[model samples]
Target: MYAVDSPPTPARSPQTPPAQHAKPVRRRSQREARVAWLLSLPTLVILIAMLAYPLYRMIVLSFQNMRLKELFSGATPPWAGFDQYTKALTDGVFWGVVGRTAAFTVVSVSLSVLAGLGIALLMRRVHSKVRIFMMVAMMFVWALPQLVAAQSFRWLTDSDFGVLNYVLTKLGLDYATHSWFVNPWEGWTVITVLVVWAGIPFLAISLSAGLTQVPKELLEAATVDGATPWQALRNITLPILKPLLTIVTTLSVIWNFGLFTQNWALRDGHPEPVYQTLATFSYTQAFGRSNYSYGSAIAVITVLLMLGVMIFYIRQMFKIGEVD
Candidate 1:
């Protein structure tokens, strides 16, 4: 009997059922989803009513042979397909305007960003009171309505009664009072100056914020390593500030491309269309000549160009982020 006694076998608990193991927790119900959609219906409807209709109308009008007469006579405009687009492409003035717009954007954005960076750096070192004063002055320039700024600049650069001419004369410089708006290059120069003046403040404020994020410790370390201020800015500050720079430059390009008020108020369609950007050209086509279809075509092209630029900008920004 003693030899026959054996160790007792260990008992195991039963395994969980396959259904219990595999089952998922309850999720949102169809009814709940439907309720959420119902709550969002007003925003959806408003977007369709306000945005969708206009966009659809614009696309439809762009493809039509609609003119002022057809619009007024209540006649259904004939479908033109790509005729308007072809015409726009072949137009010499369109190309000229494109070139002028590009030039203006490049010059204005370059100067504005550069000047803004300089001012932001300068402000970082100055007394708080001086910085505040400079900021106030910058805001004054920025707060001047675009039209008023354009007009004031025009008066200041006038051929006859300009302060510039007076100043040059007073300084004993042989400066002649030339017609600023008469020449194509001169007209663009004036527009560029006004744009840069209006735009630099925005860049300065934005870049200043970015500059503040740069670590003071890193800067001090660089200085202790015998790095010059310029070297520190180049090697340390700029790399940290790249994202903000990209944003500022991209926004500046977009803004300058769509610029209307400064160009319109400053030159007022002078210099035989040489100073016209896409915005002004579209306006002249739509309102000046009542060519609705043609105007829509121009607008569509401008929109496409802007879309392309934005796409590239976004791609570049993502690439920069990835690099970091």
Candidate 2:
């Protein structure tokens, strides 16, 4: 009989791997990814509820012409279509306030940074007990509430019964008894002094922390090479601390830009347009004038401007990081 023709065995491609018979790896990878997202779901929800929600609401409110009266009235507020933004951009008073705020931020932040750096440097060489005492004092000052600090400043600089003037009078400097909160220059002086005082402690503490991370040998080597203390600090300490300095300075700028309670209290409720910052301006518009939408626009603008400045500083910090 003719050899029985058997059905030819299905030819398997030689290039095909035996592993192809196993389950798909992609499915496992996707399952792992799902598990990861599930694990992080709580944190994501918290962030969305806190940061993202407020930000979204603020942006939405900015485009609405919602006045204060309608805030609690449950009305469908009309769309403003950038009307408030246009008004704020064109308003001379708003521009003036912005200019003043910029100047204030620059001067106040500079002074705070310089003072804090100086204090930090001094702390590095001080006795243990002295350092502890200094730290405690600074912490106390920093811990004081803004309202209390502002009030204390008012009392300390009071025109008539102020302790500062009383001491000055004893020293025969009668001019020191003049009011510090009436004239624009004097008021600003008082405000700057207080703000700088309050801000220095935090900056100094952060700098001190960064200082400890610096290699002591580098500083010693610089000194051994006939470098003066200042030269050693400039060449060694500062180079190492640049990233930290950028971070601290950026934070100070952010804090100072929105200085409200201290400044508002300094004005003693007689807030003038000349001295108002974008923050105070927003508050006045929202609460004082009951113009919620316009105030929201101001708030949005302030956040954008702050973000712009912060991004510049953060980029510098990241550049340093990359170099390292």
Candidate 3:
């Protein structure tokens, strides 16, 4: 049998060792990490410069008894330890402000979310031209500065020469020269309305974007199975939109809880005690009453509260990322 040297045995190409392959990957990861840190350095420095020292000073101030005397004299204020915190915690007025802020946040967030969700759903069912028109209108409103919007609302709701008063009188209602702020409920209603109106555009646009991710096939299938629109929404649409909704709702809570510019401007830069929220309360205590340390204490408490909300938001965001 002619052992014709079986076609010269093909040489095996040299294989890279696993350890050798891993070295480049480790080096690449280290390089990427260095690049990321380098890119973030500017932001880190800015935050430390702008925020870190101020936050540290504020916290320190909260532990002192800094009043107008110390402020003007530029003298170190005496430390009160936790006395400022204790006073705030025990004070009825402080509690009232906290309660009012919490209540307004709940109401405003609920109204804004519901209205935004409704408008977003409505946009989905509308014709393309109509959707475009709605978007244009909302964009204009959203693009309008908050200060401008607040000023406009203030003008509209002016007690004497307001268009609202004029229209109400024309319609046979006795709204002529009527002060909306006379009643706390009425004043809050106006504030709530302004906040909701301003917030809706953002919420509507964001929710609308999220709604686009809903599976058309699932909706059609649900329809084919005789599911009502509401049923389809509850089962399919809402479930899909829940994460986005949570994020927006949490954001609204944060924004509305702050509750400063609207109330401040509406009341003409000096919100009344009845209209006082946490932000206004802190400001009033600090500048209006010159109780700097007390204001700092309230601000510290506010930050802690906000931190809780932020933690919740961060956790939800992480969950969304995992799902994706």
Instruction: Highest lDDT: give the candidate number.
Output: 3
Q: After superposition, how far is residue 125 of candidate 1 from its true place, in Å?
A: 0.8
- lDDT of each structure? 0.85, 0.87, 0.93
Question: lDDT tens digits, residues 1-324, model 2?
Answer: 789989999998688565774456667656766866687689879988889878888889889998756778888799988898998999998888889999999999999999999999999999989999999999999999998999999999998778988888888887565886668898899899999999999999889988998898988887788999888888888988888898889888999999899889977865887778889999999889888888989999999989987788767755664455
Per-residue lDDT of candidate 1, residues 176-275 (tens digit): 6767777767777888888998998999988988899999999999999999999999999999998889888998999999989887877654425766
Ranking of predictions according to lDDT:
3, 2, 1
When 2 and 3 are scored with lDDT, the better candidate is: 3
Residue-level lDDT for 247 in candidate 1: 84
Candidate 1, after superposition: displacement of residue 212 in Å?
A: 0.8
User: How many residue pairs collide in each prediction?
Assistant: 0, 0, 0
Model 3 segments beyond 4 Å from truth?
Answer: 1-49
Name model 2 segments beyond 4 Å from true.
1-47, 312-324
- Determine the backbone clash count of candidate 3: 0
Give model 2's TM-score versus the native structure: 0.81
Candidate 1 clash pair list: none
User: Per-residue error at 62 for model 3, in Å?
Assistant: 0.5
| Candidate 1 least-lDDT 10 residues | 24-33
Model 2 superposed RMSD (Cα):
10.3
Model 3 C-alpha lDDT per residue in residues 202-310, reported as the tens digit of each score: 9999999999999999999999999999999999999999999999999999899998999999999989899999999999999998999999999999999899998
